[model samples]
Target chain A: MTVPAAAAAGYSLLVLAAVVAPAVVLESAGDRGGVRGAVGADLIGVSAAVGVPAAVLAWRGVRRTTRAGRSRTDVWIAASCGLVTVAVAASALPTVVLHATTGLPVLDADAGWPVPALWAVCLGAAVVAGEASRRGVLRWLAG
Target chain B: MPALNRRQFLAASLGAVGSVAAGTGLGSQLWPLMGREDLVPGRTPELVLPAGAWSPAADRLTFAAVGDTGSGGRQAMAVADRMARGYQDSPYGLVTHLGDLCYYGSVEDRFDDVFTRPMRPLIDAGVAFELAIGNHDGALHHSDASLAEIDAELRLLGTPARHYTTSHGPVDFFYLDSSTPGLFGDDASVQLEWLDDALASSTNQWKVVCMHHPVYSSGAHGSTPGADELLEPLLADRRVDLVLSGHDHHYERTHPVDGVTYVVSGGGCKTTPVRPGRFTAAASSTLQYLHVDVVGDRLTGRSVRADGRVVDRFELRAREGR
Candidate 1:
């Protein structure tokens, strides 16, 4: 059996948080300054929602305007799916940021407890916020 | 689902089994070739070094290091015996000792009972002992007996040279004479040039520099006088994996600076207080020695006390990302 659409989206949001939060922390590299703090505050605001609401609204907006594909030769149909795929892949920008800026291991016993603790906190928020947004979006679509 | 004939079902089952086996084999082989990606970061398990009471396999290069073991007393014997235990558990090839072979301020007279006697097990097992000059290795002064004394000590220890390089498995160890004038004074140009050239020319996957004085430490005798000015940048620029040193009389591992981890394992025979600096990852004033294992592109080490407790564990990955 397939997972419920809303549940899948919520899980995807939680997964996004799992990726983005550690990237932000590692990018800070134990030297969090004013700029990083600002970035974090902004991140917290975005991560708390997981972006499911916006993605849902965007997907609905496209589906409303575009004609549905009737055959395998539908190029526009593929373009619309590609847009969603790009958005899904973009959720993993955190690991990319970490790889570009630093080389710290994903887990090291010497990195102290703060890092892993932060990762856990991010996951917790992702669960709560992701589920809440997922339900809210489903309720809105039904209305 | 649609029903199938017996021959069609058997054909499908065989195809499924073949696909699963091929996928599993391909994944196992391709995982190593996959470098760090923007999506998934590469990670490997942390090893506790051989001193964690585990033995290294024959494929990897393994070694141990102890410093300030010149007293030739009970503490030294304990350390030497513990080293022998580690060797018996898994025989490593070499012990890179930095200095103070004899606390009597002489190496020739007590070469046997003081040095050889304590390490007899490892010696008999044909494990090589590489030496780097420490303060009391008879290089204290250029006295008439100094040259002969140093020569006799090296000859006895089977390490007939100073400031040389040795390769084992995938690692290259460059032993340096970290003494005063030999490393920094006017006559130091030759050794420095040789080290820089050697580091540049080395083709080993992991490069380690061994010396008597550390380039960075938080112990009583801290870094060697001119190490930062003369040696620190050289090792960092050359991309050395690890720097091993003694003389601090304690075990301290530094936070990597410029991708190089500096370790001070000086608790061989004596204990001294060490304060952890901002750059210090771990520090302890206990009698201990360091055990290192170099496998593939990673180096793992643990500073283990004579009681078999691991005081610190750290690892360094080759910058090549292999």
Candidate 2:
């Protein structure tokens, strides 16, 4: 409901993603077992790398909005964004599991996760940056 | 407190929708498992050309073998055109794309006009193509998908004789898919059996194997540890005459290993620095293709650069069993 609360949740989700996603991929890699799996796990790790930064931004944005009495709208936006971050990280869980458990590349078995991860990162960055910039500008203009 | 202002409510609603949309649709798509078609055009995966039928030369067959030329933009195009003109001057049998069909292995999005249109001459001239998958053909900053894409393309290429033995004249050719899981375990077991049977029973004079990953490489990607451990012994044991690969993005020919000549001609799309005078008898980093001349019992192979110069040459002596 509040900006701070939403921001905290976003960051928490980010940390969770960074820690858990790679573990799953590595485990998956071990099970499948090979260079292919290693590459697959690596993809999970890459997603985490991107996801962590996104989570941090979402949190900071929410915090700033709530503090500025923009919580009526910014809080909800931040919450929704936070959920998106978690979902993106979660969707990669199977791949992380595959690479972490098996030692095979996740994409080897007829499916892959890299394309979706790429698209997500681009869209996430755009949204976060757009909101953050817009809010900052509005605040400045008001002053 | 005063009731919420309409403008504030409107702005907030817009931000919420924007954030959610950004987070869901775009972020979901970024999942890494997304297909080739999902990638934005001209980003990572590039769209090359649509599929078409091609015919090989009846005699004096020639084709371009290129690798690592996927990213040079203008330079790559120039090289491709030169090869195309060469194809025109003396019609090439086919264009054997070594690998890294696109840089960073981004698939559909990575293709550009330079790659698609510049090689038009070759495509239009009816030069059949054999493309292998490269490391860069996979993922970026993440797991590589290029190998999978290569496999998909291979199947898509409609070469129904998946991993078959064929002849162009005096030369016998064997095309293989040597990617990870396939090259190892059960798949390897089956293919190896097929290879041994084919090599033992074939009537052709010269035998050669083609694949995407290399059993020996000295380029940026270097040798695949898995390949050496699993596949090299097969080559040596079979006394296979020649092995051609593409992942390294350079051209190299080696002294016969167990009576087999290992050639790395990965310069199809881009060029990277290569380790010199190591295992190779001859090597180059230029955009080049291999032209094999099969005349009766003697098969001569030349590495021709994009500029139309024959850069390297070797001969495969015919064996008696066939």
Candidate 3:
């Protein structure tokens, strides 16, 4: 119960961070140009669209795991949710950092590749971390 | 392996055909959406300038100018329609874009929707467009990627350099990339030096400068202090006749600041409310475009709205010996 509640809260916080923080940073940077407004709205929309369902499914999986014990399917579902949340967070980090540092609202020309690569790495990491926790490997390793 | 049964073989073949058909249908629909050319019609009304407005002199040159029109929405289409109509009547060979070619992203990503489709009528009619990098168009204040993408897209649109000079019959137009660093600082010295050279070498009767930032504007963005500091001295010293810009989403023409008429023809697609400042001779928040006719020493300018209403008009006569 505690694990599920904590995970859900953390996931929600991650989504909020990714969607809301960038807009604040950008507004503080300078004028709210049309592009920044559109991009900010888009980030919020995409986060809500992808985050809500992922969080719900992840919460359900965590609850089932708590009652029925760890299962491969349940772990995978939770891992997928984490992957999505992390990927979105990672992708937005560059834009936010750039705006904060230079008051620029755009990513670098080579920025497109880093986002997809981050997503892939996040997906892999989520899967590995989920499997390790389910197997108690993370607990043993931590010890 | 055993030979496939007749039933299984038929089902597999049908599945393959069905999959291919579905993929084809989806691709066809997605392609046009991505290109944003789906909404643009094949033909639109040709734009016509008013009677006797077209300059008959061989030395005279005509062009259309607008900015902040990257929306590719209804208002943008309406303005583009009017521009096409004006082109039909006067046959202007060039169009000047004052930046913000595409809102919310690099022009490379939205060029099809924001530029190609909306301006199709004019493009097909053989009109060439010159671009200035605006803040929304990925200027110096935007990310490096945005700047790179915009530069690449500009090249694709036939602008070889971000800042360069081009000439018409009697006008030497200096296109400055004001989005670069030193816009108000020492870095502007490079552009200032180039501008000084360009003005000095030009043998044309009329000298004009175009950039994305406004040096004298009363619109929402008001005047860019840096641009005023860096460019005004050069403009006044060289006796430049006209300074064209767009950033504030409105139209404004200033009383000559040191003999240079500052015009903000930014009402290309979107409209933002504006109040007249001390230097403003005329100002409006209508979606509009500008048609300028350079005949002899006089430059006649008309601001035409999306619905074809001429909202503002003014003239600038070159000073003696300019």
Candidate 4:
């Protein structure tokens, strides 16, 4: 339980440093879309690189805790943390696709459907990841 | 199964409130300092225009020139305000943009913020603008798609072609796309050949050439060696009256090099410190635009600052015969 919690915190911090920090720097430089677009695509790559290992470790820890008969609250907390990590990783996908397909760095403020759709995908990933981990499916895969 | 004590609840609420206050206070203090320099209010010295400089025989051709003005900030608006006021007194048909039209021209959305909004007054007044593509005006360093997007937007904003000419009254204006690889780098022969032909064929009395890169400047970015080497001889041979450029973000007038005057009117919206070089007759880091009136053989220019002060003035007379 402690291991998964630590991994979740570490993953969040890594995402903040790797992805969010550079985006903020580029935005501060200018409101132009070139640098921001390049950075946004790069962020998706970084998230994928960091996410795979984090998901594996989190699944392993969940299996160890569940087999040890930990409390439902403890298992739930661990699962929630894993889901949050997955959510952060999932949110970057639409941005990457948007940049790859149409070279727009930052979407216009009036971009109605795509923006909401991206949020929806992120929410869906969180819910799915949390449910799978809680049902011990992630644990079964790890084993 | 333990409820929060009254003390704990109050303490947590107080801490949250305190954190918010501290964050707000710090942000307020640092906000103004971000991405801005501390400007001191001081008047720039005015340049004196010689009496009876304009020739009576030639028809008057008036225009305003500025560069690096796509920031659409307060300073840009102020400079545009001065331009608008100057236009009313002495009506000018054209506004020559020395590029950096919008920061990171790759972004289509920024066109409205940087170029359109700030210069709305001039545009609404039916003053047409001609652009000399700058480093920031296109995605020259970025991907192909970005480059295409920027070029499309620039065309929509009235850049007829990358390198072209427009004749207005007495002045034959030749605009160069200096930001392109072929022009700025080693393979500049293509543009140079075209420039030579353009200058030689021009029938106008006052031949003026405009580009984004300055041939000679005393500002931060000094001078571009490639441009000076390739363009100077053509300008000298043709006896071009004025060569206008903007890249260094300041105003500078140079002593004539081989019968050609090189002027840097880059102080559109932003400014940086400048010092006079060997060729620099006058230099200022003030935010300014050049209000030039060509009347026959004599070309009189006044460098006007944002606050409506003329910081520099000069006159160039067309050489006798050709």
**Which candidate has the highest DockQ of all?**
2
lDDT tens digits, residue span B1-322, model 3: 3343453344344444544653454345422222221111112234433433344355899999998887654456667877888876677878888988876455675676578767877777667788877777665653677668777767868886767899877888888777756355556778788889989888789988889889988877888977776779889888899999998878999998888889999987666668999999998877789999988888899998766678899988876665
Which 10-residue span in candidate 3 chain B carries the lowest summed lDDT? B34-43
Off by over 4 Å in 3: A1-143, B1-58, B180-182
lDDT tens readout by residue for model 4, A1-143:
57656654554444234223322332332222111222123333443444445455555555667667754344544454444334433433333343332313233322333433443444345435544544453343233
Per residue, candidate 4 scores C-alpha lDDT tens digits across B1-322 of 4453453344334444644653453244322222122111111112222222223233668898988876654355557767777876677778888878765234476566566656665676677889888877765653577477657656767678778898988888999878657486555778888988998899888888899889999888888866677778888988888999998878999999998899999877666668999999998877789999888788899998766778899988986558
lDDT of 3: 0.63
**Reference-based lDDT, each prediction:** 0.61, 0.55, 0.63, 0.63
**How displaced is residue A87 in candidate 1, in Å?**
81
Q: Which stretches of candidate 4 lie above 4 Å from their native place?
A: A1-143, B1-58, B104-107, B141-143
What DockQ do you compute for every candidate structure? 0.02, 0.06, 0.02, 0.03
TM-scores, all models, native as reference? 0.56, 0.52, 0.59, 0.59
Better of 1 and 3 by TM-score: 3
lDDT of 2 by residue, B9-50 (tens): 565565567556745653455332321111111112222333
Model 2 residue runs over 4 Å out of place are: A1-143, B1-60, B104-116, B136-148, B185-187
